[model samples]
Target chain A: MSKNSSNPFTVPEGFFEEARSRAVAGASEVRRRRRNAGIALISGAAALAIVVAAGTMMRSRTAARLYDESAGWLASAEYDVFLANELIYENGMDY
Target chain B: MDRVDQRFEKIVQEYSEPLYWHIRRLVVSHEDAQDLLQDTLVTVYRKLWQLRDPSKEKAWLFRCATNVVNHFFRRKKRELGDRTLDEYLEQTLRDSEYVNYTEAAGVKLQKGLLTLTPQQRTVFTLRYYDELDYGEIARITGSKPETLKVSYHNAKEKLKKIIEEDE
Candidate 1:
């Protein structure tokens, strides 16, 4: 164990106090910066999430509309086929 | 009462001189050490929130100081390539007689420290000059206590050799 004084290194008294005050100020500045960055990130993330959700909803609504239109067209084709069969039966009977 | 101001005052009253002494030994320049010491405090204050345990504050402070010194070393390396630590210190060492124990040790210890590897020198400085325990040194330097033991021993041997040669 090297005695404390035996080891070379010394500093004036009160220097530590000055350094400490500086450190506290620096730390406060860092905290402020971190808080600002965190707020910006949160806001940015929330906006992105909202945009993605809206895009997904719009796409699903468009797909559902297309499906409804195809269903309506298919029903019209079925009605036409039924009417044509009835007409052919009546003509056969007359012949 | 402002908690931060009070905390800062308490810490300054407690560790500033010790930390200043430690940094002065490593860099071997009064002006540089003073600057680094200020930087160290700033780092400590900024990172103080990360310290969950109050008991570990001392160790944390020294860890920050070590990082500040390493940063200084890195900047020096970028500015002056291929310059040895000894050569750097020799060029920087002042010719006037040192007025105090701290100043005197600053020169002799830096000269002795040159004999050790960078890691060994750091270990020795933290352990001996700074009077940090093995565990504290380990925390500050990120070396295992067992590794610090080995490094300290190696550093002591090298320092003894260097000091003897000078004698």
Candidate 2:
């Protein structure tokens, strides 16, 4: 095949240089974005873990407090029943 | 830079002009060609590790370039709602910058090229201008060699008629 010697297109001065730099810079930008995304992913995971741990700790504390309150109420009721029985025996009103 | 970056730089320096012209002939605009070349190079840099055989670098590079050009056309087609790709390309040729109207024959040839379909134009340019063999083009374009030969023949016939009528 016969090759055509004439070219109709023209480029700006230093266009190749400019394009080369831009290409490299664009690759660098991609790398930077990937790195940033990875960092964000790790940070997100860490934050989620912290939140879960805090929630678990708070839930454990709440359960302990509820248990203590229930135990105290049961003890107070037993003490009141024992005192009422003693008063009845003292007054000879207990069969 | 590092070793990989150095290798990428070498690739850019070596293939930039050839790839630019390869893209320019298909896209018909300097700006679009430049952008596509840059995109191609950046892709090459990122995917350089995938290249197991260094012997196929040229074919791989051309493949990347073709893919980028195809994507550009697809996007333009979408943006140009209700209009065909041929019409959009014709408009682009009319309004494109960095073109030499002084080269009347060259300009005429480019116009004739635009008259052909995208596949025909690509096959013709790679075969006629870039002087790539049908096997290489087949690898780059992922088309059968017989198909490319037919496209090139048809493209040549069309361009010949267009040029003959213009004379």
* Number of the top-ranking candidate, with TM-score as the measure: 2
| Model 1 residue B105 lDDT score | 42
Model 1 misplacement above 4 A? A1-18, A75-95, B1-13, B42-53, B95-106, B142-167
Steric clash pairs (candidate 1): A16-B16, A23-B41, A23-B42, A27-B45, A27-B46
Q: Give me the overall lDDT of model 1.
A: 0.75
Judge candidate 2 at residue B1 and give its lDDT.
Answer: 75
Q: What is candidate 2's lDDT per residue for B36-105, written digit by digit as tens? A: 9988988898898898887888888888999999999999889989999888777777777788788788
- Residue B135 lDDT in model 2? 93
True contacts kept of 1: 0.40
Each candidate: chain B TM-score:
0.87, 0.94
The clash count for each model shown is 5, 0
Q: Would candidate 1 be rated incorrect, acceptable, medium or high by CAPRI criteria? A: incorrect
